[model samples]
Target chain A: MAINPLPPGAGTAIGIDGLIALLAKLPGLGPRSARRAVLQLIKKRESLMQPLARALAEVADSIRICSTCGNVDVQDPCAICRDPKRDAGLICVVEDVSDLWALDRAGLFRGRYHVLGGTLSALDGIGPDDLNIGPLVDRVRKGDIREVILALNATVDGQTTAHYITDRLGALNVDVTALAHGLPVGGELDYLDDGTLAAAMKARRKF
Target chain B: MAINPLPPGAGTAIGIDGLIALLAKLPGLGPRSARRAVLQLIKKRESLMQPLARALAEVADSIRICSTCGNVDVQDPCAICRDPKRDAGLICVVEDVSDLWALDRAGLFRGRYHVLGGTLSALDGIGPDDLNIGPLVDRVRKGDIREVILALNATVDGQTTAHYITDRLGALNVDVTALAHGLPVGGELDYLDDGTLAAAMKARRKF
Candidate 1:
């Protein structure tokens, strides 16, 4: 792979190019943004970059995926799983750690989370056995769980995975629910697709 | 300062909050994007995160601002400053290291660089002494400099700084020149400002 997008003279110094390359691979950063980021980091070496580097090192050294819920954390069970304050009976299932983080950021969900890693994708050769479905089923079957919130994406694969999980948890006497489809806050009706608009219209309540 | 924009439970994990906070401060990365980047890093811990962490640490430990020209590099004088092949008598003055890097990336400038750190901004209380103008003048006065290219931004402050630098180098026998102003390549005339269009018209060459 073309790791360094920057030309030879632009980053002739060792590790600078490497750092930029790695940063570019991040979610919201491209080559141009990565270059800018690296420059900013270098400029504020003492104040920002050093601290960030230390934090990254520390996180890389300590972080682990929770074997039970698949949440990324320092602890094995993760903070949510370990938290006695959270509702252990309720589990909110998400497709990835990012989704779990997003829900956690909202601060409304007082329940535990189950990260599925990804949805069922026949094209990608991913199935139930590949995901955290087995563990989720195991958790649900153990009978302490009162509900399983299927907070998966609205994509075909996501819905498919959710349906499969719902089927698996059918034997258990647990309440299964998915996230309500609605027009997003600050979202314009004209911008929304037919599927989302239809779903939102169908799920509309007397508000 | 509120470093982390994410709610409490979103990053309750050990060192994870700190990492997210740090990542959020980076250019092109907000709290949401930072969280996503952090999750990605965690997911690809061994392949991406660890290597990035190591590279960041290494760069932070070794990188230094070149005392001679203020360019960032692993060495004190920097590779560009120490390079024997580059034209020692010609110096390109840029407002920031990023500008210098951009020029270097083009691979056309065989001359050395002089990073001004920033432009002269009286409102911001930045003066000639705040920039590397003194060092640049000193470099010229000490002899060998045949030309000084002012590759500063097209902003008012940038122009003012360039003029100030030119004034400072008045006593020296150095040929000073600013970058030519024109409509950028692939830039639409309608999208361009009046000043750029006028400049481009005035500087138009026979095809």
Candidate 2:
């Protein structure tokens, strides 16, 4: 039998095999999608492949963690932390940089952000030390931050982390607040779970 | 509004924005997944992002089209075409390199391949002259090939291209054959379409 009778990577170019292997490790991309992507990328070398390679290189070289909030960016403190117009007095706490991105996508949050990096997970052995809860407490104590909003997900780990942070900042004199639980914007009563319906009813506002 | 009140790609590092845009352009990777992938890439910079960047750059720099088979690799003849063990007398023609990869994945076909690049599409203005059909005919004419297998998709354009190629190679004295159409392996009979069921019944073998 020939060297590559089993398909790619086995007999393909070293560069292609390496690229496919790395691409497959990405969040949503599997081995099959990675192979297809490599083919398309090579086909569109000038238009997409070269540019993507350059971008990846530049990002890998320049990307840095924000010492202030655990956010990843090219700069030290990050853009959000450096922005003068943003309300530094109000800080929104989140579990990950993805959460920060999600909240920022709404364009409604005007305050600065504090990325916890992760939440409390007993099963995974993650605790307060593994998170950035210490830095958050320090920021609240040192700065004029009046309120700290917990915008974590509704998951058990997320809520547990939120509560843990709330308790940690209780002595810091900062008004710790959590996001209001309610039915989603397009969520129907019939489709919503009992927890969501109860929370929506409990937080119901009068017209 | 602040520089990046609307989220990423606006003021969040030019490298990151460029990476996300290019990643989102890939198949199956949308804007949301792209952002998440970037975040993960940055987080796992040393192991994933840096290595991925190097891999991308290497692939972009070294990748080349197989002059003989239209397969994209780091070599002109491609690994499959250059393999001495492969049966050069038998050629499997496919619409694209993706099809070539799919066929090779089965590891059953021990022959060379001819990538047409794309199928004949009158609607899209794609014709025999636009594809690698000329090169394929030349390869068959010059080489001592005895059989040509049309492994094109079952789509209208695919079948049309297959017919056109068959007519072109009719006088070449090569035995032209197409893949047998039948119900796919692991496909349930109940889920099989009418056309597939009919083909399966008609192509049934001796018990």
Candidate 3:
């Protein structure tokens, strides 16, 4: 993780350094990669960077969180919540908006989503109140949701949050389930951990 | 590469899919990473994305190439070319603006620069006239320049362009030099090719 040696007032000019600094903070980019990206953008300013800048502005201006499901979109209820074809009775709960986007990219789930923002982290002082668990329970209590799928990550905090949500929804008549734990597609058995292997073995299905 | 399965009118919201598609075309980003970046941007719209949009607009509006050195900057002459501290007798010739940016990041060279835009690639129909070679030669022929350092890449085209420039500047009194060819710092010997090894041996110096 080498820091960008070029400071603000160095040989590099103007907003270019600032853009690189901001781009470097992205999830998959470091300073070097950010510099490369910025150069590429500057070189293809008309074709790429300008369009991206415009698109970013448009998205920034239009995007908002769905009041119903907590998903970010251009509309209040979001496209997913507004879609008439998706199953409103099936709500998929995820830790963050990124998780929702990932599932959407998979194109497998045809249900609405509930973004919890983050899992219940006792160490980090994140409780059920800090998340969207209350709203999710309220959605279930409205008698529209038939199934509440806990599609959170297979982490300690994720599981704890799921359990807490289940407890909160204990009085509801809806069924609750979780994503199946098993070897991922194209995954090798040798690379799997003990917990995953145990869970896979316990839940083994007949072919 | 896995194509993004999410189509234009799929469950994903409007403008978001387009943004992801455009972002995926960047140098180092893939569809998955682009999706993650977009989600992150949307998540921190007020703090990060909005500011990025503003900075991008500002840069796009202000950035232009310097007439003398071809360096991209907010000013016409560019800050470097207008600086009175730098050496006017030395000029570093590079293939593209990105190369000039790389050298500027190094912060070692006090001389100005000449961006050739591209090498003399016969395969791609690029020739001496297509690049900024004529202007470079004109600048050298003016007799103020004492040295022209060829800071092009180690590629075959780069070397060919360097040779062509050398020939073009032959009638002038300016001295032409190139970056030294040797093993890069922190490079593993076993991983190096025979050409690099030979070059390193031929240019060996007593420590």
Clashes of 2: 0
Return the clash pairs for model 2, or none: none
Give the poorly placed runs of model 1, Cα more than 4 Å off.
Answer: A1-11, A185-191, A204-207, B1-13
C-alpha TM-scores of all predictions: 0.91, 0.93, 0.91
- Ranking 1 against 3 by lDDT, winner: 1
| Docking quality (DockQ) of candidate 3 | 0.43
lDDT of 2 by residue, B1-207 (tens): 245453433446476777899999998799999998898898798999888888888778877788998988875668888777899999999988889988998999999999988999999998889999999999999999999999999989999999999999988979999999998989999998899999899999997
Q: Which ranges of candidate 3 are over 4 A from the true structure?
A: A1-12, B1-13
lDDT string, candidate 1, B14-124, tens digits = 489889889999989998899889888987888898898888888888887888999988766777887768999999999998898899899999999999999999899
Ranking by DockQ: 2, 1, 3
User: Tens-digit lDDT track for model 3 on B26-59?
Assistant: 8889998998899889888988898888877778
**lDDT by residue for model 1 (A1-207), tens:** 223354434545457888888999999999899999999888788889889888888888878788889987875667777776899899999999888888987899998999999999999999888988998989888749999999999999999998999999898899999998878999999999999999999988896
| Candidate 3 TM-score, true structure as reference | 0.91
